[model samples]
Target: MKQRGGAYDPFDCKHYPEADVVMRPGMPLAMACTGEKARIVMLAGGRGMHQRLTSMGLGVGSEIEIIRRGSPGPFLIATGNTRLAIGAAMAHKIMVIPMEREIE
Candidate 1:
């Protein structure tokens, strides 16, 4: 599917065009566009960080949306009913796969 950026890749979805571009795989959450939907692919932090995020329901495979992307500040993300304000450092450690989905 097509991500906010023009870079393209063939993802699992078949509904979108085969030529659709996706953001680079494993892009940091901090770089994700606001309102973009993505799935957690990997966590590039220590055990404590992993545990903390997992406890907050942000483990791998979790689907989330960017509510706010504040450069040099905390990023706000929504996963289900849970909203989290995460520091840029922490956000950078969270790798995600951008997804193309209708937001409704």
Candidate 2:
């Protein structure tokens, strides 16, 4: 079969869609883009009770997404089902998935 320009050919293992567009909004970004490893360093900030949410086992290292940004900006993170609301400031420091490869 013939393929268009740049489209991935699953059989060839040559094309990667993500390679072209690295980071994007409203989605989780790869750690490699941030130069951070599995262990990300971040500060706490968000809702007035953001610090309190930190202790809820949904901060740093956990996969999260930028749901929105504003005076009451909130994060829509997948921590089970509840949408975790993290302040934009804290989101800036808190990095997710480390780019380091796992050792065998």
Top-lDDT structure, candidate number: 1
The 0-to-1 C-alpha lDDT of every candidate, in the order given, reads: 0.84, 0.44
Q: Per-residue lDDT tens digits of candidate 2, residues 1-104?
A: 24558674544444635543444222232222322324333433456435665666665445433334334444444454555555555555454444354234
Question: For candidate 1, what is the lDDT?
Answer: 0.84
Best by TM-score: 1
Error of 2 at 96 (Å): 1.3
Candidate 1: lDDT of 57?
Answer: 83
Instruction: State TM-scores per candidate.
Output: 0.71, 0.35
Worst 10 residues of 2 by lDDT: 25-34
Check candidate 2 and list the clashing pairs: 37-98, 38-98, 46-87
lDDT value for candidate 2? 0.44
RMSD of 1: 9.9
